[model samples]
Target: MANYFRDYADLCFEAFGDRVKHWITFSDPRAHAQAWHSYNSTWRGKQRGLVGISLNCDWGEPMDISSPKDIEAAERYLQFCLGWFANPIYAGDYPQVMKDRIGKKSAEQGLDMSRLPVFSLQEKSYIKGTSDFLGLGHFTTRYITERNYPSRQGPSYHNDRDLVELVDPNWPDLGSTWPQSVPWGFRRLLHFAQTQYGNPPIYVTENGASQKLHCTQLCDEWRIQYLKGYINEMLKEPLLSHMQMVTEIVVPTVCTLCILISAVLLMLLLQSQS
Candidate 1:
């Protein structure tokens, strides 16, 4: 993958430029610039459509917010997670604090570079405004604080980012174990993305809830409610639109067979009565 990242820019530029209107590059603009700066720098002059990366974002709120520190901590948490990814695409560097924080910890973790990634001057210049659209893939939300922030020793990606953890108190605990239903957080997250990232065209690659119990008698009212809230929040602005939802459900084979047998039995009973 490293070798591919190092070399594929020229190949992709030649092969894809003709048909590709817009290109979604990499999650790291620094790395993206190093790879495609040559292609993108002149591609614009040649009338080629621009490229950008799809950043993964988890938008959420703080669980404990009574203290002022908690509020600031929450903001910092979100900024480090989502903003750290978006800032380089627009501002051309990882947040200064993040760089410093990671730098201090890298020695202990045996990291080669600040796990945050590096940006070259050419790459920075090339990556800025490279995104024709800001592709964001948001799945769930997390509550955060400074105390909750973990060091590089922690296993989870968020922990490595130095963010404390939390969950929405009121969010429903259906579908998946990790995702709580904080539909309001989705709206807040979108607004943050708009305000922070120049309101670039946002394409939401994934957004949906998980499944609960599987039975005809079991109502999916919870999922329906979650959908209503999330969709309303996303559709608030006419211009902010993106992917169509593709829902995949696994209907049990036993359930299908049971329905077929029930239909056949009902028909036989009705014919005998007639």
Candidate 2:
């Protein structure tokens, strides 16, 4: 499977390297280590353009900021989400908490080795320093708490983290079921990526709100607010000046298309640092 992807990437580079300066080998590589390992180490050198992956995650804030367990759980949630992919690109392996927890659970299940994949020393060397940039996709934030599930519940990915997710009631709901206007989370996620991944050039591949499908509202005030709030947070962060933002406005109503375009243009103008 790894070789198959390597071959495909090689074909793409051979065909389009002259025109495409930025090349992303994968989007969210954590779900499949094999693909990341193959692209990062094997196929990366064959291409002339910059190579990286896009990772999407919501910010995890500790439910009780003063509690050590809650803090650790919050960090653990990030490790499980972002670090699971970013760590290997930056640090060459999985986060320590993931290894320890997964190893222990695998042992309890009477397995000889961890269900979490292991990378050999050579593979680690290959994977590390492979990314030229980090692509990020962020939306909303969640309040997290320490919650341990019984082993009897079986060994799924969610339960292994030993944590629970919550949302603050005070956050403004912009029509989406999950996404709330939590700009702080966006800032935190950027800081974590820079600190964790050695300040790699970041591209925000996705971030936005979802409105009702049938609602033909021309004036998307909620989405405009969402963009302004999130982008303003990014502008305030010293570490996030050169990042790119990718967003889509769902304009089901054709008459309101001009309004959506104007809103996006306004957002871009406000986002401009100069």
Q: Write the per-residue lDDT of candidate 2 for residues 1-274, one digit (tens) a residue.
A: 6677766766776677667767776664633344444545554566545777788899999999999999999999999999988888789899999999999989988999999999999888877776777889998899999996554567899978999999988999776586878998999989888877777888888899887445675868778988999999887776343332212233335438878899999999989955
Query: Which ten residues in a row are the worst by lDDT in model 2?
Result: 242-251
| TM-score of each model, paired residue for residue | 0.66, 0.79
TM-score of structure candidate 2 = 0.79
lDDT tens per residue, model 1, 89-172: 678877776777677677567877766678888867765665667777666777866574335455344554555677756767
Candidate lDDT (C-alpha), each: 0.68, 0.80
Would you give me the overall lDDT of model 1?
A: 0.68
lDDT at 235, model 1 = 81
Give every collision pair in model 1.
25-52, 148-164, 149-164
lDDT of 1 at 197: 78
Model 2 misses residue 242 by how many Å? 14
